[model samples]
Target: MLALPASADEARRSGYDFMSRATRAMQDEDAANTGMLWVKDGEALWNGKAGGANRACADCHGDAVASMKGVATRYPAFDARMRRPVSLEQRINLCRTEKQKATPLAHEGPDLLALSAYIGMQSRGMPIAIVMDENTKPFLEAGRETFNRRQGQLNLSCAQCHEDNWGRKLAGNPITQAHPTGYPLYRLEWQGVGSLQRRLRNCLVGTRTQAYAYGAPEFVDLELFLMWRANGMTLETPAVRP
Candidate 1:
């Protein structure tokens, strides 16, 4: 059994810490990281002209290296128009429909994953830094409730495993504290890149629960809670997981 970290301050470990040395090495080296392939694809899409606007993300954002730095850390952010929090994926789709006059990318589709991974990469190593305000407080509370609520035939809440039983093994895999730092990552099990929602769906299915449809508000609320829980952790876009 893995030993728990000693205190609340020490409790928040990145999922990377639970990885085997070889997996950690894989995530460390870009050349070996399969997720970089999606990042490359995303870069191409970022520069390619899209939609009726005939504009690339570059047209408005300029050099992503500069413009997108630290941006991912603030997401699951409040959207004034929607009067609720929106995930980065939703934000991207909104830009597609509103600014680019393009149809939204399919949820969990390669193009969407590629673009998200690309944007997430720009903020690599930055701490998660979501701000809480009056407008976002209610949503945050809802997220917290979701994290703690028991559901499914197995009667499991996210906190049961991630918060209470972390540092333990489940089916030979170490159960680390749930964190949202390395989203749109590469999973060896999937043989490709995937979003956090995809992983969450897998968990819900494992627990014999009905998973939410992609882009559901419930998923976004849960994501907000996870990101807030992982506040101050470094971003590791395109992280490798086994």
Candidate 2:
């Protein structure tokens, strides 16, 4: 398991007030967790042979329950081969292309999301534990800058709505603290599960700013920073959201 911080306060925040009590309850109920469907599909994918090598993830990783537990909490990790930070999705794709000799799944595709949800589910209740070493520090700083920089026609930064005016209403919706613990979330608006990058893109569009493309370096950096900001928060992958 990933190591927890000495103090939970390292990046602690209030409970997820953005969600209603009923919605929160639904998230905790396995029967109601629509994201579990994806997890099930991912389980199948993990064991099934694929690609030219005809290898399965199980061939190398063995049981996901043991190997993947708490793995999501430490993601957007620094990869020496890539020489940069890579999100869980990026790492999954890397494995598909390089190790499995399979074509990489498209970003936000159903298969990719399913696999991501499966891996992430293994880390449920774990705290975010992104490493902040010298190699990752620069990206973290860049992410912080991006979070603070005012952009778009609205001329607002991420902190304005989330940090400064949390618990307030924005366009009839509650402004959340922008925590990323509950990701690959099943959103009512989209009527489907989506990655954090999808939500971030939506926020950018809401701010009337041109959103970054999927798999962009900026998005990965921002993800690393957000994970840092939410360090110590429990993993709530495949969470339900309004």
Candidate 3:
């Protein structure tokens, strides 16, 4: 059997400080992160013409630097047309199909991730500010339930590790408060950048739970909850993690 920390406070203090030490130094620096390669690709895609309309994102949105600033922090927002909450990835696809007359990129595909990364980079260092009004409450509640409900062969809930034992060591890994700040991140394990949904799927699998398909409602709801949980945390797009 593995030794456990006596308390959550002790675990938080003594566990390996991955955020500060193990992760690449200045991980979030655009010049340092390998993930920025995708962002560069996305910039090219934004300017280049595409699809039936022969319109680039720049055609409608103008310069992303000016139009997209701080836009990512408010995402996984409610989309009235879809009648659901949509992740930044989903929203990008929606625009591509509906407005740009372009084919929607596959979930977790290179181009999609690149575009999402590019957009997310604009919001780096901005605080997450997803609004939770009456309209959004139902989705938020569903996310809360998902976070708290135990599942999988291990029967663990997200709260068990992230809330109850945060800062503790699990299989020699220090568990931090699961924040969504550093997304579209370059993980040492993946050797490439990945989205929050990818990370969430890994967590679900770690507990031996059934992972939801990409773009599933459950994933969006969970993401919304996480954004709400990490409310006010600064964005760290393209961040490096061990």
Q: Cα lDDT of all candidates, in order?
A: 0.90, 0.86, 0.82
The per-residue C-alpha lDDT of model 2 at residue 178 equals 87
- Model 1 off-target regions past 4 Å? 1-7
Error of 2 at 220 (Å): 0.4
TM-score of each candidate?
Answer: 0.96, 0.94, 0.91
For candidate 1, what is the total of clashing residue pairs? 0
Ranking by lDDT: 1, 2, 3
Ordered list by TM-score, greatest first: 1, 2, 3
- Cα lDDT tens digits, model 2, 38-125, are 8898899999888888999999999999999999999899999899999999999899898889999999999999999999999988
Name the weakest run of 10 consecutive residues (lDDT summed) in model 3: 8-17
Whole-structure CA lDDT of model 1:
0.90
* Pairs that clash in candidate 3: none
**Candidate 1 vs candidate 2: which has greater TM-score?**
1
How many clashing pairs in candidate 2? 0
Clashing pairs in 1: none
lDDT by residue for model 1 (1-242), tens: 11224576466888999999999999999999999999999999988888999888899999888998988898899999999999999999998898888899999999999999999999999988888888887888898898899989999999999989999999989898889779999999999999999999989999898899998988888888888878778999989988
| Top-lDDT candidate index | 1
